[model samples]
Target chain A: MQETRLDTARIRAARQVIDPIFLDTPLYRCEALEPVLGCAVSIKLETANPVRSFKARGTELVASLLAGRAAVCASAGNLGQALAWSGRGRGLDVTVVASRFAPAAKLDRIRALDARLELVDGDFDMARERAAAIARSDGIRLVEDSLDIETCEGAATIGLELVDAAPPFDAVLIALGGGALATGVGHVVKTWAPGVEVICVQPLGAPAMTHSWHQRRVVTTDSTDTIADGVAGRRPIPAVLDDLLVVADDAVLVREESIVAGMRMLLDHAGLVVEPSAALGIAAILEDRDRFADRHVATIVCGGNVDMDAYHRWVGARS
Target chain B: MQETRLDTARIRAARQVIDPIFLDTPLYRCEALEPVLGCAVSIKLETANPVRSFKARGTELVASLLAGRAAVCASAGNLGQALAWSGRGRGLDVTVVASRFAPAAKLDRIRALDARLELVDGDFDMARERAAAIARSDGIRLVEDSLDIETCEGAATIGLELVDAAPPFDAVLIALGGGALATGVGHVVKTWAPGVEVICVQPLGAPAMTHSWHQRRVVTTDSTDTIADGVAGRRPIPAVLDDLLVVADDAVLVREESIVAGMRMLLDHAGLVVEPSAALGIAAILEDRDRFADRHVATIVCGGNVDMDAYHRWVGARS
Candidate 1:
């Protein structure tokens, strides 16, 4: 089967629009984690953004594209803040529909970004559905995570940066969420650094991508729960699934406890404050350190939008 | 009085030793704060390091310069972890003398950096005295904070980056500790952008630099306390004092409450997790927002090495 490729022209155009507002997050060698893994390891720090997440890149691109249109989206956390901030920059109205489960700090952030907040009933799926309906009714553009090609392209820039900054790695561990980040990053790595393995890591409780990969089709679950709130989801977007299948060499589901451990490792060793989803790749590595031993690896610290309360709980729970 | 000029040749040589190990942190426009400040506000994000602080640069430089020599340093938090990490990288034995007041997580980080940790009996002063004694008695190279010219030059790279990255600003806000960061940054800013204002910000409770500036001489106090632990000191080093006096346009003392507010603001608006010292400049801005309402301004986010427990307490206290 032919691999589905990103529209380079569209990506280039989106890059031009988003370049001014977005940051080119740095890619640096993780000397500390290297010895533990027994391989040369580098980390692409996407947490350095003004919004402290990679969602800034995707949402910035989406917001820029919808310059004249009202922008709407549903997010668990980081995406809402990103969209709200980007929308504020462009002088566009933004409405964020968030699940009740979303952190108070994240909701506060969305409001701080000057976005109209809608607290929806039920989980993320229901919130997203409500957002989509509002967008359709109000003639606003719903910047759905899976449907936005620009979001994926924006994320692909990470792969581009990694390939440009560091030597070829044996594997790239990416946290799988709406699949845009993994699919986009995987596309670039598989295409440009063909020898490098691309591993998509998902939370065990929400293994939509893993299930999709095994079944060779898009999959969705009725119920999903995980500590990695950013990547906790049921549905796999078909467009992203096609790209993930083509580009990803393997998939791993990390335990929640390990994810907490990864977060602790990040804080203690790397001095990084990352959310559970951001630590998913590290969690995967921690699960079977020997498997990644003696192989050059790169893991994306995708976001740092964890709420203070959640962080306190996780730290307390882990300690 | 003449300024203590940075030895550019030495800084250039030091860069060769340190560049590979440390990140060249970004100097970019603070878009969110700029409109409020009414001047072009830029910030140097030195917090995007392994230790999540600018101390990494100085520690790396000092460690590399020490070559095969054993190293010792006294730190509130960031410096110890930085030295530990850099020392480990070079296979040098490192001992960090930290005060009991320092964060537990910071001690963990120092250990994680593979350094020998020594918890001192008292505050940062006692830690410094102990480190100095150890270095002298054991023939280990002491990576003293303000007294070391190399450390200052290493930090001066922040100024160099700022000058190269952004156009000249009217003022630059720096949080002063033992004065290494302020002196280094001030030296470069004054040399490169002569017209730029250099404002030194100190916590009201720990006003070593402020007292020195007022008395027109180095000042010392028996004890000092402030939420901005990174900048909380009772004495100013004479080596940095002369340069600080010559280059620093003025100095401001920020209230503890304002500094806490600044931290929350960064987390809320800028999506940044900054320690109190890093927020001092922003705190100063917020304190007198009308004064800076319309000026081209720049500030350094010196470090991000706050204790989680301390952070929780500070935020809780503020609320």
Candidate 2:
């Protein structure tokens, strides 16, 4: 196996630098969910913070390091909001590029956070290209979500906290996006608590990261279609794929129907208004009940920034 | 004012005895809620814990003090779950009495927590009588939710946390139940952060606590009707009423419509699936926006235990 470059020491150091609001989130057994999931389920809730997502942890760390400098990033929603929020009060300047088709709620939030918002005519890929062009032309740094080592290190802090959860989970499930959350968390859990399996979940509509992880190389899809915009990455970052190669034990693609059902399950059982992306972990469990049955399983409810209209359309339909 | 007996020192002391899981809950400003609420709002979330309510703080403290003893209490749902959960590892034996009409979700949760449950044929008052009878006949302790000093003291810990919230709030709002959470939090806030107004909220359908607070005496209503079962007290405890008289600076009663609206607001803007009882504070603000507009205000999102059917009927309807 190739020697892992993701440093446990730096990940540990990132803990102190990450905002306290993102640290020590609720990690407890959801008895209500256990019966439904057919497993002893523990939820690591990352939605209770200001940005309503775990993306802030990495963005905050990355912003802190880039203090007094301007940075640009392309996001469907969450990463942009995190960057704008973390950049505020700090000397750092942030510009977010998003597709015109991005959720209005997310775009409005990004603007409210005082970040520069640039709307592209095309999809997320085009937005990424626009961000890169802006960064080059404006002589500013382009901060890629998972491609940044600091972003991964910041996310690894969650793994540190997860290992300390009582009764100890047999497996940990993470939502796979550009691979920051999954790989970052996977690295720490695999390195420290080797006994616990790190399973990454992706929407079947957008399974580039999962496919790339399995193939042990970079992969791209022609298009993406999913309610879980957070994990709908058509193109997987090669560096993050490398991290997943060593760290992630397995990756699963869940049906779109399962995502909606998972959202309803979380709302009914756990009293959480989670985005579809956050529901992917639960959907993964719902897809393969036998693998997790009777075992203590932990999953990070990673975000809760869903648009109300979409939420009603998706989850309300199930109810 | 009459001499205050809800001890600030005991409330502070109770902090250490309470479960760590119930302490240091998310206390942050929700920006998305600000525009809708017409104010700078900070939500003290008590819903993300094991029991999904602030009830655990008091129950844990009360349970700890009653170590190796048998205790009984009547609850709508949250309190019973708290007691059952808190009394688990301890030598304490817990019994919960409830009206047959109590939400099935709560009943199932209480039963799951290993507490002995007694269902009464009539209302909550009938359940209370049954609990008292059980206590007397079995030689067990009758643990009143707010009447017990430890319960209030445990709840007072939230006030301690609130006073430390950043940018400092102009006023704090709390949902009125048996008066433990409101009076406990009020006593601490009024005593320590006297500049911050302690406002208590009750549903218009069940305004016994509000009426009692305004009238400066105990008051009883023939019936109570509200979706917020946690705060649907028809009769106010005289002792807890006395504490409320001293601690609470103001009390507001909001309509059932407003309570439903508040739940929707929390769900849409704050990304929290709070129950009607927990939404009382938000309802109060919505009813009288002029009183809270532009002011920095704090409200305890005190619980998240709601029947899914009720959630859909109330919040889902608005969407």
Candidate 3:
């Protein structure tokens, strides 16, 4: 198979250029998870960063390269905050178009990072269209998640940090949304340590990435209803779709119920209160324990955006 | 004042001797928290370790020095698990004396780490008494938390890693129990960066450490009636009490209500499901936000051994 992973050397450079806050995060063994999953699980937590997500890495590199150019983008929350925060260092101002109904905490973070917010009445897709239109009219560059090479290369820094984990991991599980995070991490993992398998996990509610990978083309779902807002995407990013075809060894879809269960387990056992999307990796492992039994597995905990009300409601429903 | 902090040289040496799992934890700026508290708050998360606590650092160093000798210790939970996990490397079998009423999840973790469990019929102090008796009869060493210099030296390694933060913090907040974690961390901060203030946090329900600091000697309380089991010691360790006089600048006692509030905030904002004792630092901050306002402050997030039901009840109470 012709593999077109992110440039290995560029990833190394990106690690140096990106914001240090996202660098060298905690990659520790979740002791309770080992017995439950019947495997040694090392979690690379992205929540420790200033942005509380891995989005900062890619955005930091992208903004640094923008070189004072103003950029317009659409995001539910994480990417917008990353861009706004990283852009400050490079004098690249950001105009983020986001859903009016987005979480207050995320919206507050973006604003605090000094991003100018354009609140749209409709959902995430509508926000994207508004960003594109604003970019055209205002003459600012429009950056989309999972579609840019600089973004993916910057995120590949996860590969650099994972080297520190004792009893090196054999396989990696990552939640696939627009595919930037998975492809970036997979690219580095495949390049730095060949034969290490990369598995993409997608929510059953937001199965665009998984569907597209299987069909060998882009896939669009009617709507994404997953509580994991970070990985809930309706349409597949074409560039990321192509990237995953080369880098992703396999993909799995997990139920929303399993996502809730995974989130609860992580809270109770691992002491992490991550977004439902972050739970997708754990959800996948829990859903199919036989496939991963006794394997040295690692997963990227991509975000920690859930609030108390939402967290309580999700976990409380099961009880 | 000729301060005898844990030999700064020994802390450097302990880094090489201790278990690797306890090193290089995530220390990052909690951006959301800064805005709320009106200060720059950097948190050193110790809960990321294999045992989900900083106790591993101390025990690892202690066990390594023991050279396969059997040891008996009494713990509420975190210390026992840390000893059990770290001792496995040095072939030091551990006998943990725990309260019969200890949390099932914590007890299970200690047992899983292959420690011999002795559940005493009374409270934590009674368990300590039982452990002392066991050590006397078995001719094994009885290692206490704060009395041991090697253990404190091991935990001081956190100070080594905190140098990575961009702006130097002016103050540090830590939860004090038997005081191994606080004294060790304080010892490093005091020796290396003398001006940085060390503030110890004790549960209002368990104010032995704070009371002892005021009295300039050991203090014993009738009962420790707080939800933060990790820092609920009825009696202060004498060596640590003296260590606090030189290394610590101040001590604050926080109410249980604030701990629940602090835990909720970390869950909602920082994405950490920590022990109520770990919440004590934030609780102290919450209890007196004005005192920390505009200061570059740091806190040690010491443990995350909370069970699902306890977590649900604590955070769920607010909703």
Candidate 4:
């Protein structure tokens, strides 16, 4: 609604401030997977970092801004872990409010990083409310993932790196959640590579952002059921959606089956153990082969943080 | 053997010639895995590349030298793929001889890279002999993986990058096959970081390299039986062993079960789909926890190229 603070200058500045671990991630063409996916795919892998996700980029910058102050946030899992990890090194106390259904692997990691965790009984929306209330009562900053300008700007560093390094692509498909990654990356790509399409992909089971983007208004879903906990959102952040509407060329929804297949394909062809959220781009390719057929496409494999047991079930279900 | 030529200077020079895709791989301490592995573990991830292995470093450097000349080499899988990839772009004809038992995933990739593939009936030793025959008959240079100074020197770049980038570590355990990775990394680590112990690890099923390093001579086994095809060597290259002996502080053999368990552990904790060879360092730690407990240890995840069916069987067998 107000003047946008997320710009190329801030993202370039964030690159200097973000931890080196989250910067300069692996971006390479997946020749091994091209024949099967029917597209020349270049993966900007965000999984190889310490947090095994791209959240560290934003969280690190956000943590730096909150020098000695306490911060609170709600996450499905990755954001909490990223905040905990970033906060630990800076002596910044962080409390994460998460849905009770959040993966055990992430909860354990959050505690391992010495962060206080509060679990809400209902969905992510409920957890967000709890986090806001905690921040308000305790007089701490509520660092929202997508709503925070610094967080989105920090994430925009990924786009800066991608446009600078990745091979020429016709379109770039990004996994859409609360829109930090999509909006951040979309902003840079649209700004620099205007011709390249910035497509956002969300799981069909949780299509809040996808619906909101198409309608140009905030859309809320009744429930979220996807295994892709990272992108499983019910309530869309209106501010993030406004930004996404401007940068996103198109938004696509993928099936549950396709997500599992995408994960298996990555593990089999590319030797990557991508989580459900990370596989969204690949899932999009699987669902609509004709759209990406023989075209050069780039996608950010944004995370790899799935429980082993859950991973086994997802990959093992089909074959 | 002649005076050694693989050194840090050569490795430093090789870094300039080798493809940037293989240089400066992700080397970070896996905090998530430290609790389970009983040590501060840093993984030099070599899987996130075109060839999906560390072999590209040597192969790219070697390919540059044979600009217009044809070359032949024998490989279990990864070296062939790397050579094929490097050679494809350089217009240099390349031939790879491999055992029929080599993973289909690798064989398919080798062919995809447009290299001539020769399948031998027996083992890696038989493939090596066949490759030698081809080189002699065709009047082409036989590029040996470990014996070649250029190849080993190329691999030594990993050591240079590791020492230059990674945090302080007490020891580094590398997978030992023909000894390119182990000897190359050992040379750099021993030369520059003299205090850091350089250990070589091999599968107990194929202990020729370990035995040869210990005895200070070549040791040939009757057969090699291991799921880690990348490091399943029965014949130890004397030249590589000579170099390995000077740099290696210790040589350890890990059980087959331990190697499988290591792969699973890396998959679960580190979010890596490492092949059996890549897991050797983790396997070594798994076997001798006391040897690495509370110590900072670094290990190169050398490769990740295994058949999906086989990968499923390995990770699925126990769980």
What TM-score would every model get versus the actual structure?
Answer: 0.82, 0.96, 0.95, 0.97
Superposed on the true chain A, the predicted chain A of model 3 yields a TM-score of 0.95
* The candidate that achieves the highest TM-score relative to the unseen native structure: 4
TM-score of 1: 0.82
Question: How well is each residue in A179-297 modelled by candidate 3, as lDDT tens digits?
Answer: 88888888877766667789999988889889999999988988888777777778787878888898889999999999998987787678788888898889988999999999989
Per-residue lDDT tens digits of candidate 2, residues B1-319? 3456687778778878887888989888898988888998889999998899999998988888888889999998888999999998677899999988888889999999899999998778778889999999999999988888888888889999988776789999999989998888888888778899999998888889899899998889999888888888788888888889988899988999999999988988888988888898889889888999899999999989888887877775533
- The sequence of per-residue lDDT tens digits that candidate 3 reaches over residues B110-210 is 99889999998988888888989999999999977777776677777887776545677889898888887788888878777878888999888999989
Chain A TM-score per model, please list them.
0.94, 0.97, 0.95, 0.97
> A1-319, model 1: which lDDT tens digit per residue?
2466576556556666674435556666666666555666677788765666778778878877677679789888788888888888887789999988887767877886789999887778888899999999998888888568877887887877777655578899999988888888888887778888899999999988799987889889987889888888787778788888888889899899999888876764565778899888888888988888888788999987777667756856321
lDDT ranking, best first? 4, 2, 3, 1
Which is better, 1 or 2, measured by TM-score?
2
DockQ of 2: 0.56
Task: Please give the lDDT score at residue B195 for candidate 2.
Answer: 91
RMSD of each: 4.5, 1.8, 2.1, 2.0
Q: TM-score of model 3 relative to the true fold?
A: 0.95
Colliding pairs, model 3: none
Candidate 2: tens digits of C-alpha lDDT, residues A1-319 = 3446578888888878887878888887788988788998888999998898898889988889889999999998889999999998577899999989887878889999999999999888889999999999999999998998877878888999998767678999999989999888988888778899999999999999899988888889999998888888788888788889999899999999999999989988999889999998899999999999889889999988878887887776433
Model 3 chain A is weakest, by summed lDDT over 10 consecutive residues, at A310-319
